[model samples]
Target: MPANEKLKEKISHLPHKPGIYKFFDDNGIIYVGKAVDIRKRVSSYFNRSAQHNKKTLKLVSQIKDIEFTIVDTEADAFLLENNLIKQYQPKYNILLKDGKTYPYICIVNERFPRVISTRNKKNDGSRYFGPYPSGTTMHVVLDLIRTLYPLRTCTYNLTPENIAAGKFKVCLEYHIGNCKGPCEALVDEAEYNANIAQIKNILSGNLSVAKAYFKEHMAAAAADYQYELAHKFKQKLDMLEDFQAKSTVVSNTLTNIDVFTITSNEQCAFINYLKVMNGSIILTQSLELEKKLDEDDTDILASVIVQLRQEFESTSREVITNIELRLPLDNVTITYPQIGDKKKLLSLSLKNALYLRKEREGRQEKNKEMSEQRELRVLETLKKDLRLTELPRQIECFDNSNFQGDNPVASMVCFKNGKPSKKDYRHYNIKTVVGPNDFESMYEIVTRRYRRLLDENQPLPQLIIIDGGKGQLGMAVKALRDLNIYGKIAVVGIAKRLEEIFYPGDSLPLYIDKKSESLKLIQRLRNEAHRFAITFHRSKRDAGTLKTELTDIKGIGLSTADALLQKFRSVKKLKDLTLDELAAEIGKAKASILYAHLHPAEGENA
Candidate 1:
């Protein structure tokens, strides 16, 4: 295929699917990448303004053909991409090379199988327990199982025919009582299988079955006056409890999992992997990835899981991530532990990822020439995160405040280059709409604010933020549309619930990363607008109350009210005055009426 036509065809056919894409040439796959949208990411490479590095440009030049594998999830794509990259050793991809594999506990399939740890888990007839994060703790579990149960440690097959022929002899393991000497027919198959069953339960982190069995036997023995056997059962149960107490962190019930966390900046992502075995962290390691594209947390995490598992040789079948991750592992279970020991492990993993991110950022800051880079990075991130056409250098936020259908007011706060511009701050009194109509109040203020700006030829903000949800945002958008600035000005609403960002005419909220500076800036704007509106509303309410306050008293006209206000200056001071004291200021008849009105409960004083 001709290069231009092939490129066009590939670009046109790219689907908005989550998967891994490979760039191939005469030399084979030169680059492999995973994307939530294959079309977007791939087409971005072809855009002349994508600002490709020299290495990337050279790689793109060598691309003769493109191939892709669509997967069920971003995580599946991540794993597949990692595998393909490792298999082909793609030159354009950054490899996190490590030589260790995670270990798993295997119960060998036999008439009387042995429990042991191995690097690989094969699907023979045997039961496999782990791809444990920590080999050391798994080792302890194996030892604990051996300590609790008397299973054979011999190499002899101990077949039934051989035992019947009396061909096998007891070994040192039998002499030491580590084995029940099944080779010599001292132990039968049913007794050996029972011990194996209990071991399987323990290895799977379910001690209840074994504990229940032991307690049942102990109670029955005690009922029969078999004190020695009952005491032995009690000792075994106590031993199991002690072992579980030492290994378990949050709860004794949680076990056999790997916890993962991810933290990142614009340039890189730091992933922390926690090897959780038997509800305890056995080992932890943080790996850093330099981002070639702007990938989200799931993308970064999914890719890292495959690489981390492959690099560390992890055999764990259960994965606990700080956030939800859907991977296509039929044998593996994925979870987002919100509480208990698993939650704590997830948090610890997050802490590690955060620490690594901070350390790397600190190192980078030291090497850089200016701190303004941080500010630029924030602006760029804010732009991308909010999906703005340009940087939000100038932003205006609006809020409405009212109390019990009285004194409705609105406030607009302006932020320029991420700092509050108090000079441009505005407050509006609701004139067009009566009662506590928040949506209409928002419309009035938004229309008045922007219309005035237009009339006066004042510079309008690049962004308008409404301190509300979809309803208020639509009202504001209507105001803009009436002014013919609907599409010209970028307007959005920030709902207090979930800090959701809602666009005009859209019910689905856009959730930015909670830790994102863009979201923080939006939150700050919303809060500032709220504070400004509340302050305005309070002052307006107080003024309205005071204006009619004196007139409300009986026989007090405007003149009398003005006379009393002038004499006392404050209504509170006038209310405190006795009839005699008030009589000195205004005559006794007026004083009696004023005092009577002020002290409604004290009719005797009137």
Candidate 2:
């Protein structure tokens, strides 16, 4: 637990930047701190000649792992650190809890609603845009809106009657061309309201609507022969395009999406959430969770989505993750993006998850042991980790294998006491599920495997590993439910992304420590199942190709195919068959047809 040679070596990767760094014990969060220079500040804790402080020394002694988040600036780090420390309430930080709040952009309630940033949300009929990631983001957005719109940023109430009577005077904003003198009726309410409508669309992550509105106005003005008006609308469209060109990525249509990634140790899970609006990341943060069971990555991400959406008051219905998540949330579309900006967001979340996992796992190396004691330990850990009534000494992991909807197959590999029990491995040629539907393939295999086991009075595995996230796991669970054996054995899904452990009927995935034996055992079983499935699939394909002579021949069906195979098993043997020999088994006409099909040059010469 001390900052020894290993800790010294690990800290070398720490960058010189403003960010939040965390120290942890074997169990959970212990301390969180922010630094202007994270490496220098963290490096000071292990300095030999540093001032002897009782509390600091005690905190350093229990440091088993380290993790951090890098930010753009010191102020962002400060805010993030404060946000995290307050959220986690780490042991080594200040205990004051009163000074905690994040910034939100508020559109003030008035005739010309003044768009401004505020920490407080008021219920005065004004619309609010964000709890943006940082103040810098809020200011940038505010500047963009102001530049695009000529709305008055003043305190005056520009009522229709007041404007008609000319009760208000032109201000500095009007003189500077920032406002259209709405106070003096120089700009009508209809025009000002149109601008407000466009601003609302932009704030609501509907830039496409705003852009279309401008383009429509431009087209209409041109059609009416109003060259001057058309030029003004063209100018607005050009300005909007120029603003969009500076965006992180604005060429894509993806908007109003949330991305999440999860990483875990045996004790805790770290989940990162990103909110994207119009191809721009508006808010992002990573949070931790204490695992109560063998939770999977899908479960952890699902729970994190619910918690973070509530925390940030976000209503984004589209969520992108590396794995498809089946969440309890209604009207939310959870997609696994294979490409585009959404994929980038998913990758970003995964990168954060991996970084956190590396920080936690860098301190320990797996002890490869095969003793009876080690076997018992793995079983005991498995039982406890899964909260199972029986030890998972007998484990079966299932994986579905397919290549572009061909030769769909499933494989089940058995493991006893954390080691492969290859004698009981099973392979299944998919019968029920057509094409490359993995979930249905999994369902078909699970039903067939367990049904046969029950019929033959064979022992069922104490655990069943679904080599996927929630979807395939759900199919297995459904199979268990169909057989009326839903809860008799422990079942969990291991996702390839973030190595997340998912439990059925849970929202969050149980993130096990990367070095934990239970995860290692699960990973082994998963790999073995995948390997067996792939090998079987490849063998099936190879056998099919090898015996393709009968199948490739013209007018040869399975029945006749068997006849030809029974006579001449190989293509070379069939090629050597004379017309008279083929006619003995097949009809003379069929024999001639086969000869012409197989021997094209000889048929032509004859």
Candidate 3:
């Protein structure tokens, strides 16, 4: 059958039930679409008068084949459509790219396991809590868990050999009462597992039960005359109580659902989702995408449903029934429930979404205005401060750092329109110059960075900023001139004490007008570059320290050190291994003698 005839036959077979349908081209590129009535939705496309937009028209023309899944209801269709779109990443669909899976608190299925944040959510007999908004939030919660439970966070495998060798010792966390020190066998397995169960309860919102258990344990410790243990439990109980007091309370009437609201401007549309779980507002995610509307709200809602379902599929609860949209759901039950907490939650979510949309729009406008004002101010300031010929739109700042001239490094941070262009940030390791010669290092770094830019056919920055006055700027200018790239780039220097700005040709220091936003922005960019350079330098110094310790060994070089560290994970782990094992891991011939020093029981002479 011909492609158009196949699509027509499939459309004829589509049911009147609420569901999602997909259109595929000759190349098998799928375009996902949702509808309240699949028959009506699919049939409308065959009508030329109904085609309102270029995209829709294009979609109609490309429909070589059609397919759909029958849904129980419109709500199910809305959800299932999202899942398919996310899975398929249909070429025509507006995809929301989810970066990393959000962190979730996991209680591992071990006798003395720890509470930790994991991206992977598996049904491995361990209870999981969250899909927390961010890693920082997860870290904060993990810290609180440690404070409350005092469970061992270590991944120390409980093997017979390690136990017999007395290799396990109580860590600082245990000594400080943040952990119960299971590695040293200070706590029995049953007791540890019981603690984990209590933690799971606390995380799952049964805080009252968790608190009662803690209190009972504290009383038992006190009765046994274990004052130290009693005091530790008391502290944990107090912290949990404090946390409960501060957390927001929700009404019992609200159900788990996601409420969506959309607001649009000329250029883009903002779609916000308010995720409510167990009557509490857990998170809000807003997506800004290209606007396309010619008065079909159902079509818009359909598009959003297709887009959003993919986002919520992985971690959100399966009990989601309510989805409040700006548009009517037609045959799908997009309920605007009147009266009760569900209605109130939906109202609040919609209001928040609209407010946020307006706020973001306002901020963008304000930022544009601020950028213009700052640019004019920077021009005036530059004319006065550096006595420049004209206002430089593109200013480049350079800073260098080193350890007593050892492991020298530099970084270039760029600023355009009074904002840092972090994409333009570049790093350099000082290869030619040695020891405390800041000017030479600057010249070399700047030359190399710009030379590569030139080779790549990239435009030169209008202004150059150096960390020091006159001498540094002059050296940079000289290097530029030597490379026949001098006049195209202007050089400025910012000094430490007076925060004075200097130009390449001029000997005197210059200062910007006080409290200028442009000056603040430039300083921030320069400081960021300085920080980047110093951080890189410190990492190099640390690596050098490691090399000094390990590289002298016959088989150990930089690559070998890296391999050992990658395999063992830490210096402590590397130290714990016998020399023969390390040699075997790295395939080194000096294994036997190294084993003698590390494990004298082997009897080979070091």
Candidate 4:
């Protein structure tokens, strides 16, 4: 295996320190690797005595150049290699096939921190918890937090100066006891942060701390003879216990450890991770890697261990895996249990990995069949992108149109199985809202549309799209909340400016790829809604103008004006008609009055 002279010279000068190395071909970098001894590692690839696998032989054959970055330690090298593999996505590195950004519970860094679910983890100093593998589990944790301790959900800047200056008011959440009135300074900063601290503990898998806090408060309230306050604390404690019990408890002995397992075929590998806290599984995640080389399970698992631990920020000292792998994690103990509670935990993790592999295989089969129907494939894409529990077979989008508050109207366009269901489309004349209030108009139309569906026992749409920003979307959420059907169906708002998708209660908007089919489908629905609303609004405005012009005449009334407009489509066309032409369509008296109103100069001349 003789390398090029230039490559040989470059490899000869490689550092002996721990670092990452890259192999570049004519096109670009094809592989990235980490090594404790960079010189030794790169030299092994070109040694004629060492037999190499097919993938490695092919990779080494294309090596036109080599680059290396020296780092402080082996751990740093591993981290850099993983990051480069993700960034450049070198051809020969293990490919993470999921291509998904797992959701994390973000505690926004602000005066009044918002606890919300976000897929993005930023470095702005706010705490993030759980790149949760399951959205439902993350939501359940979030719901429990909100239930036990009321936090502000509104994206209000509740600074000290703003609160003192009376710049904000308590919202409906405050009235409903879902938020303490922190905006108006009714809740002190210290007390609010105390709740945040407990929230952090809970999210960090220290449920015992939260339970103890509630118990201590409950005891104090009871000692003060405040039965109601004591009862509230007791309820919170009970909820915490219930939540804890629901989590899988693999063992009472194995505390604060991580369990990992891996399974693979020739093409790809699957790895499952379990974060165990106090002998209970707090988090479960599975990852898939496409094997470009003949990498063993030990190497794949070791890479995933570093990646997942860094992602989830696990500081557990002990890690139990199904296979043995030596890693350079500081102060961490890696163990492979043969039999015991640790073995059961390992078995549980392996089960999840196998299940994920099975699910992916089945999905691939289903996707092949789905390719036959483009609509189904698009719907599948949408379902995955939006994290919807079910396919959006039926989607309805709403848009409102008005010109300076007159003749306001709204249109609801329905798409069934990725195609317009024209018969299911609807138009609404603004009934409740007085002026050009898009938010209220959206609320009214959404309410009216769904209420009618509910009344008639018709099936509701799987998803609702509001063709506006967060304001309009929030109002729709309020309407659904009032109707007690807020979470029954999935809904999002799409802003036209950037095509930002706003989920209910999420302050941050999701920006889908500009070229994605899901976004294209959403945009089509939005455009259709806008076009429908604009057309209806134009008709209404024309009708209103025609009526006003004709009724201004002495003898004309509502029915007569309608009759004249019905006979002739627009006021412009009616004005162009002769008086005899108008009289032929309507009665002589009303027609003459309308003709006079239309042609005032002609009336005076006659």
If the candidates were sorted by their lDDT against the true structure, best first, what order would they fall in?
4, 1, 2, 3
Worst 10 residues of 3 by lDDT: 313-322
lDDT of 4 by residue, 327-419 (tens): 787899989989888888888899999998999888887996676498888999999989999999999999999998899899999999999
lDDT of 2 at 597: 87
What would the per-residue lDDT of candidate 1 be over residues 456-548, giving only the tens digit for each residue? 998878899999888899999999999998888789899897998898877788999999888888888899999999998887776666657
What lDDT is obtained when candidate 2 is compared to the true structure? 0.78
Residues forming the 10-long window of minimal summed lDDT in candidate 4:
1-10
**Tens digit of per-residue lDDT, candidate 3, span 1-606:** 334565777878889988888888858746776677999988888865464577677767777778888888776776777678678877677656555587788888765676888999998998778767678766766777777766777888865566557888888988887777777677787887877777777666557777898799899999999999999889889988776654433565654556666666665666666665545555566666654323233445556654554444423332122344433334333556677766666566567657877888899999989878967786667655555676667778899897776888999888776667888888888888868899998889888988898899988877788887788888898889878898877777888778888866777776776586556756886798899899888877876776565666665567876665455444555556655556667665555434443455556442
lDDT for each residue of candidate 2 in 432-452, tens digit (9 for 90 to 100): 877789999888999999999
Estimated TM-score per prediction? 0.50, 0.40, 0.51, 0.56
Q: Each prediction's Cα lDDT score?
A: 0.81, 0.78, 0.71, 0.88
Clashes of each: 6, 18, 1, 0
Query: How well does candidate 1 match the true structure in TM-score terms?
Result: 0.50
Point out where model 4 deviates above 4 Å: 1-3, 12-18, 48-50, 70-73, 97-99, 219-230, 358-606
Error of 4 at 294 (Å): 1.1
lDDT for model 4: 0.88
